[model samples]
Target: NNPKKTGPTLNETFLGLLYPTENYKVYGYLTNTKVKFILVTTDLDVRDADVRNFFRRFHSAYVDAVSNPFHVPGKKITSRTFAERVSTIVKSFGLSTAV
Candidate 1:
């Protein structure tokens, strides 16, 4: 792999947050520590229920795919397993179920 083409070296925190590098399309709601719910969206048009579904999906993806061990320390992520995990999450947390 070309060092320059791979982009500059990033810190460990940044690298850790970038595991299982699969691209995803997500939609959901974010609840902060203050208990405020913030709506999130994607390029796709979705219903309230769909948003909930997406929220769950994103949560799973963030937990599983973005936390895989096989993923490299500082390289582009491209894992089919990661994509599958995200897909499952998306379906389960679809925005259509958002309240």
Candidate 2:
């Protein structure tokens, strides 16, 4: 039933070719440093431009975090401030999920 099984997976192809699946839509941005930023949204009507904007903002925040002299690169981000900043950014986009 999954169309992905009939063809190449996202990891096997270019990021630009990836599309939405049944239950969720995936958008990806691959950085020159090989860092991949992915966003999964349940709203199928979401436009590509919105996704691009989200990635742009996220990449900026990520860079700020990694650029800190005290922050180590390639390690799990454990900074509470960074986590809060990311959460705030996501919420600012009105993408918060309610249980």
Candidate 3:
């Protein structure tokens, strides 16, 4: 039972962890295919506009992953490209600003 291969790796594909630290919040989404997405994140002080954009980008990533011919519906997403996209989304949480 290797930790790397333990359980469905979908949890990691979301954000590299099953859950975040204390004071975090959880969000959910239901895809057209009945796929449910739940994610936890530390309380963020991001702007409303940023939050919308963030979800949009995240959803885009998920769609791309599922669209992969090798991906099996309702199964763990093992695409390295998907994981890297998630990492990038989390890293670029917020960098743009205007006044």
Candidate 4:
């Protein structure tokens, strides 16, 4: 591996933590086209890698949802594929073995 690269490329999809609260924290990811994703969790000790993985998987689901030829632009996503993927991602949050 090239020593120059430390980790995954800073892909615009998984923007890190936005803010933290006493009981929980909120993270954000904003797409270049302005779609936004938010994740709030009570687990303050969660790792950045885990959060990144969550958003990356969620973003992939969103992308796949809108990739259909018949999908209308600007319409809300109701795809089952996206729903299932997101459900699994959310349920597996903070689990190192999830990936």
> Better model by TM-score, 2 or 4?
4
Q: Report, for every candidate in turn, its global Cα lDDT versus the true structure.
A: 0.45, 0.71, 0.66, 0.84
Query: Which regions in candidate 4 have their CA more than 4 angstroms from the true location?
Result: 1-10
Tell me the tens digit of each residue's lDDT in model 4 across 5-98: 6654756576678899899999988886789999999999999888888888888888888998878989988878778888998898898865
lDDT of 1: 0.45
Clash count for candidate 3 is 0
Error of 4 at 47 (Å): 0.7
lDDT of 1 by residue, 8-59 (tens): 2432111111122234343223433222223333434345445544555455
lDDT of 1 at 77: 54
Instruction: Tell how far residue 33 is off in model 4, in angstroms.
Output: 2.1
**Arrange candidates by TM-score, highest first: which order?**
4, 2, 3, 1
Model 4 clashing residue pairs (backbone): none
Q: Candidate 2, residues 33-59: lDDT per residue as tens digits? A: 789887888877776656666777788
The whole-model C-alpha lDDT of candidate 3 against the native structure comes to 0.66
